[model samples]
Target: MQIKPKFGVDQLLFGMKQTDVKSIYGNPNKQFKDEDQNVIYVYNQQKMRLTFYEDEDFRLGYIIASDPELTLFNNTILGRKATEVQKELEQHSFKTWEKEDFDLAENHFNEDHWLILQSEYDQIVKVEIGAIIKNQDEFDWKFGAK
Candidate 1:
């Protein structure tokens, strides 16, 4: 399947994309979900004490940094999609549940969440985007003349 590159605030603001991200970073050590449904992707830049998550519809979210709250565009700290749902495991003592409809901005924190909750149109289901970052360093750059 063909995967088109998606854009986000960090990517648009910093001009970083997936390819640029992977070239200079490592893999995330943790991945979790919040109360909403936005999948939280976490990447550990051990030396920098930073973590990232990729949260959005298919591909709207960007790489979010933890600690200082620095966002690195184009790098998905966690290798998960917002539409993905992690089955509640038995060890965590959390029951298996699906993501309900909700927004990331209005209903949740911008640092914690990305968008706002505006789906008042039905019983919505979404994955919770916990404190994570989505690193998108996987595509080739097409902008600017280098």
Candidate 2:
């Protein structure tokens, strides 16, 4: 019950609005508007998926997860053993990368934040967190850039 790995929780960072993400994760069992209209929010009991745009006043911006009880910044959870969470995200300095035919693994704490891991026989089913938007056509209409 300690899932505070980042990408909006303790001060709700990335652009912030939507009533400060509904005062921190409330009322979103589901919501929609995509096709470039943005404004998506799903919570599947905290498995998470948030994306808001309406030209930034809708804020939030994106935070998708596959939740294995979701944890990241060093504690690295989400079903573990993707080489032990890529050696605890390279002992906390991050900078990892591996695609391995889509077994996937990534960690780029720059170019506007990142962390994704998806493995199969080696555990870690899925986990994704991306927040980049420096206006590449509004981040390709809210994350077709991913």
Best-fitting candidate, measured by lDDT? 2
**RMSD to the hidden true structure, all candidates:** 15.9, 12.7
> What digit string (tens of lDDT, one per residue) describes model 2 on residues 95-132?
54645553345332323245556666666766665555
Q: Largest TM-score belongs to which candidate?
A: 2
TM-score of each: 0.25, 0.33
lDDT, candidate 2, at 30: 86
Question: How does model 1 fare in lDDT?
Answer: 0.30
Question: What local distance difference test score does each model get?
Answer: 0.30, 0.59
Q: Compose the digit string of candidate 1's lDDT tens values, residues 1-146.
A: 11112223322222343344445554436545556653444555421222122332223133333222322232222223322212212233333333343353212122323322112233112112222234553322222326
Candidate 1, residue 41: the lDDT equals: 42
Record all residue pairs in model 2 with backbone atoms less than 3 Å apart, i.e. clashing. none
